[model samples]
Target: MLTIGKLGQAAGVKVPTIRYYEQIGLLPEAERSAGNQRLYSRKALDRLTFVRHARELGFTLDAIRDLLSLSDHPDQPCAAADAIAKAQLAEIEKRLARLASLKVELKRMVAQCAGGSIADCRVIEVLGNHSLCAAEHGPRESEGDS
Candidate 1:
């Protein structure tokens, strides 16, 4: 058995993050040593690794929880997992489209600037008056859904 610190080190996750995962039920509660220190088995390390990878891939805690549940039953169909991945892909695509629009607007604003004073700056003007924008590049209704 490994101590909590060792488990965190092997999993490349912070100690507090591991604790948070446990608190949120993403990780199983760790066993304790005779002295009351947290002890973890190799299985815990593997689960932590999986959680870290899923987090790096931008999966939310709830999605990671769902994925973990699905993984626990390997014999089950993968359609739910596939659907989750597809939803993430759609979200990424929407963000990409928004970013592209922002790029175009920024380019337009910069190209229109003649390097005059701030009062004559096209970028400043457009920013001050959203009506001057040719396209809607503002935040979406679900901007902070993640």
Candidate 2:
């Protein structure tokens, strides 16, 4: 068995994040040692490693939870897992499209400036002028920000 810190270190997550995961039911509550410190089994460490890897792949915590549930029931069909991946892909595509639009607007803003001071900076001017901002983006299109 390992302490919370040790498990976090092994899983490449911070100790607080581990505690938060436990609090949120993503991780199971650990048993206590003689000193009343949280102790984790090898199973807990492996679960945390899986969670970290899934997070690295950009899976949301909700999705990870679903995946974990599916993992617990190996007899279930994989279609739900495929659907989750598809949804993630769709979200990524939307974000990429928004980013491309933002890039164009930012380039335009920069092009308006010719190494001038903040008072004459076109970037600032455009940002300050909400009217100049395109409606295709902004909060409407970008549910997620880069």
Candidate with the greatest TM-score versus the true structure? 1
lDDT of 2 by residue, 18-108 (tens): 9999999998888999889999999898889999998987789999999888888889899998898899888888787878987888888
For candidate 1, write residues 5-73 as lDDT tens digits.
888899999999998999988898889988998899988888889989988888889999999999999
lDDT of each: 0.88, 0.86
RMSD for each of the candidates? 2.2, 2.3
Model 2 segments beyond 4 Å from truth?
117-119, 130-135, 138-146
Q: In candidate 1, what residue range of length 10 has the lowest lDDT sum?
A: 137-146
Tell me the lDDT of model 1 at 12: 93
TM-score of 2: 0.85
The TM-score between candidate 1 and the true structure equals 0.86
Q: Give the CA lDDT, 0 to 100, for residue 40 in model 1.
A: 92
